[model samples]
Target: MRREDDHPKEHCAIFGIFGNRRAAWYTFLGLYAQQHRGEESAGIASSNGKEIRHHKSMGLVSEVFDESSLDALKGHLAIGHCRYSTTGSSLAKNAQPIIVDYSRGTVAIGHNGNITNAEILRAQLEAHGAIFQTTTDSEIVIHLMAKPTYNNRIEGLKGALKRLEGAYSLVLMWEDELVGVRDPYGFRPLSIGKIRNAYVLASETCAFDLIGAKFVREVAPGEIVIINKNGLKSIKPFPEPKRKAYCIFEHVYFARPDSLVFGENVHNVRKRLGKQLAIEHPVEADIVIPIPDSGNSAAIGYSSESGIPQERGMIRNHYVGRTFIQPHQFIRDLAVKIKLNSVGDALKGKRIVVVDDSIVRGTTSKMRMRSIRESGAKEIHLRVSGPPHKHPCFYGIDFPSKDELIASKRSVEEIRKFLGVDSIGYLSLEGLLGAVSFDKKNYCTACYSGDYPVRFDENVSKFATER
Candidate 1:
């Protein structure tokens, strides 16, 4: 409901529909389901073969669109995006389903991940007399595709995608066709699904379920799929990378528990992570409690494994909006306090094992623990399902840099003391790998292990673009 936890945030979610008469309407529903990915912006672009129309704004999906607005974006093909700004400012202009016009036709793109080479590419494109419309990395793809290097639009798109060097799962709408492409590394999630005869695509399978669409499969790494009146056609344009660096943090955090990602159910993997956490760090607490929503599944698993009773020690207010204007220093802390309230009945006089997914900055964990202790809790033992986020993520997840991470410089004991918890334990990198239903080598654990799968140029840093 809020950024109360220290978990990493996913960039955004993308959804596209082709050959569906209810494209715009279904797009709204899909974006609503994926509002968790991004609350700062919501947008949809639609095309009826000849004309393209779009509506986007800096707000949640429900706040941005109404029945009249959805009806106005009438088309058989549409692509929608709900964004959590990772690389750009949280402004309305940066809202996605970025629509552009070129010689080929109208093109709109909704991108789900960050582009690591965006700074270099943007500079190169500008040197070639390119005029940029927005400050988003997503615009790099549009400019690259708009160039006249290839004979056909499809060839141009393929070449443009080949030049991309970071996480991107895209939903692009061209005249008469809707296209979906996942980066060669598969750093983000995108799936192909169907609602009867109409083909659908989204950043997660959860979007399909909301609109009663049947999930088919994931868009292959380095592959592109085009859906038009002629039906779905596949194009493999790039060779697979040596290692597919799918973000494992999708299971630990960043993903909605109801969604399926990286070929595994997010909820199931999180529960398994909790079970593994208990095995790795056993404690004798009277009751197991989660921070709520983010920690709910893991706490349940911990209780199941340790034979400790599970209770809802905290209640989350689901209606908390993304932003609030605070006029005072004490009011600033309302960001976390407004969303969570310690249930005194379950927490009072109990030695509690408080389970959470991860701790990004120690401030949130520290403040949350203090609130629990003030609620008459006797002892608070903090257990995390994911390993310490010690390094920055270069993919879609917007994790803070090395200096911002509490675990980067401090020892575990130091972190426990800083957070003011009786004790603190985090899942090991090995244990986290064991919990996810995939081979360890395939998933990227750079944030936890400080081992980046994507190499960087000598001149480039994660902050190059921002700088």
Candidate 2:
């Protein structure tokens, strides 16, 4: 498991490919490209049109599957999942591409977001004598499918989907077809692509790029696409939501810079955010630097807008795995040290401005700033590319309780003092909304503004599955 990061933890990633003889291999490559979204576990399920096969394990994609494992999963249609347990324990059994043998042949689902009403639905099913195999919110869909009143399978799937309350970008596979669906509000991203004779579905366009797939388009909000030997068909099963709530964090932090999500390129949007941040809060400094990869694009925009030259002031150790064994407390203190190191030569006696994405709990930012100061920086100013995170996300992204978020309780000056930085500036809410290419009203600023489009029960934590 990863330590509490400086930003909210990514929800999950899902990918699927149809009509490929080497479906599992290609799905593996797609999941590898999306590993940054989730690293707790990886899984893939493939079908030969008669039956479905799957392999899942509790580790990174590379660690979970090898030559022998991938070779065993031969099929024409495949769906893969990489998970970060937002509501349940991080067990291998919970790893997805959740395959089940229902009455209408076998089906597997790779899900990318949380089902807010999982507990309520699970209870209702169990009262009807349902016995669940796993404690993930995603399993509720399979159970609902098994008990649907509709005779037609597509209608049944649609019925099951309509019952879901919150975020979901799903890729489902059965004997002869592949289906992809996004919730009505589009709380998570899902994309379509094509390669050779195959059709593809994934959490981001970056995955499609990895396997040489042509960019198609985003699976529409409240839309479902079904692919078979016949071709692809679209289904609009649910009523339109009151308004769209595309997770704005995807542009700020969650997505890979190379991906196109929610109608724009993530890198370009982030650069606009940086330039806007500089225009909103210009700081006079000797040099501008990014925390690392996530902050790189924004730093560039900041440099160009503020006339401050940007350089790599911090070096990242990419080899550091999510978990490591530390024999002593002294070694444990080096958690931040293991992942990041200050470029001392660049920082010595310089008035530095550190451009970072966001500050979640303030712990990581404090550690980073302390490290930068110790490297002989005379003045340090921190610039954030997004607004203060004041609420925990119930849609998909995993944030700690509201009290754990430093910005939730502290003012700007308080946070500056806590981090020991000379000054701090966060991008304004107006600046953030302006940076996105889509309609500002369509994006979710719930975490920043506490305007949740969908409300969850206060007792949400009781639902182990969330199922």
Candidate 3:
């Protein structure tokens, strides 16, 4: 069965290290740091200049690899992946850092985003008798790279990348070369770092910090960065888009608060959003409380801006399993109940304001509100840092269908009533953009505005090609 959550799920995390004797070890650490990005499965592939070896399974990073497994993958060039499966089902066969032996030696790929045109491209390739081993959109790239028309590996890679549409931040290793590529529109985050003489690539900078790597810069949009013994070289083969579409949700919720995403510190950006949200919607309350982990920074900003004392009203169980195998709805509710517990002392008899990042399905939010009410809160006002998520996200976030979104059809008043909250306030789209430090036009708000930056076949369901 599929694991379900109220929040949007990130697709994957990719990490690579070159010019290091302990490349696999460093890659392991990097993926461990960004484990928040994906938790369904983890994998790592390494090249010892002549051969490529890999290990992957349907589990967390720590569960998938240990010292013995890392030691077996002997190489100075390695790439790793942790996935939550936006394009494929959560099965062992779909685990990544997919290795392929082809016309141009062996290459391993670890991808971070979704390919919107995968189904169309897959059909075209299938017509030509191309065989696929896995039901993942990422395999399409390897097949394209194996085409006979391209003369060299780099040319083949560029040709394949140009044909792809939607989000992709890839880490590819071919023999001794370690490469990273970002889509022209830059819908996902990828960064470059250096430790000693080694070059590192990862989905977020937090990975670099874990491996003691110095932050170099971000992989530019439409750029391919190649790192080998000779040093790092960059090439841009595709035409640039008119405007960049960096995922704004990275700051609002997806990314680790300690990481730098799209050239801005995530925690700082979230604080700004909270401050802006407070400016947009202010309420008189006795105490301000956050929804825990994701809501911590924003709640701080809200408390600071509103001049209300902030308290930890809810305690999160960090050790809770990602999913529960329950036979009944009540059992599932018990699983959710164990994940968070309301503090009666802080919330009891107090008019409280709860700050959260976003409300997706509203089921979890409703449960949380019920918990607060049971804790004796006199009044509860819910404030969201970002605008209501009304549409599905086709680019890497595992957002539910439009009908599944509570805000898709219901009005604010109806949603407030459904959640059993005194009032609900979501930051306006303008306010969300205002909080971002970069050009507002560069960020994608498709989940809120239904304005997709990269065009896709509207008729097809986002999961049409997934197995």
- State in Å the error of residue 331, model 3: 2.0
TM-score of each: 0.97, 0.98, 0.98
The global Cα lDDT (0 to 1) of model 2 is 0.89
Residue-level lDDT of model 3, residues 1-467, one tens digit each, is 43435788998999999999889999999999999999899999998898988999988898889899999989899999999975448778889988888988999998988899999999999999998888888999999988889999999999899899999999999988999999998999999999999999999999998889999999999999999999999999988789999998998999999999999998998888888888999999999999988999999999999999999999998876565477777777765567888999999999999999999999999999999999999999999999999999989889988999999989999999999999899999999999888899999999999999988988887766676
Give me the displacement of residue 399 in model 2, in angstroms.
Answer: 0.6
Residues 1-467, candidate 2: write the lDDT tens digits.
Answer: 34725567786899989989999999999999999999889999988888888999998999999999999998889999998775456877788988888778888988887788888898999998998888888889988877647797788888899788989999998889999999999999999999999999999999988899998999999999999998889989788877999999999999999999998999999999999989998988999999998999999999999999997899988988766766677776778878899999999999998999999999988999999999999999899999999988888888888999999999999999999999999999999999987788999999999998886886776234633
Q: Rank the candidates by TM-score, best first.
A: 3, 2, 1
Write down the lDDT of every candidate, Cα atoms only.
0.87, 0.89, 0.91
lDDT of 2 at 119: 88
User: Rank by lDDT, descending?
Assistant: 3, 2, 1
Model 1 accuracy (lDDT, Cα): 0.87
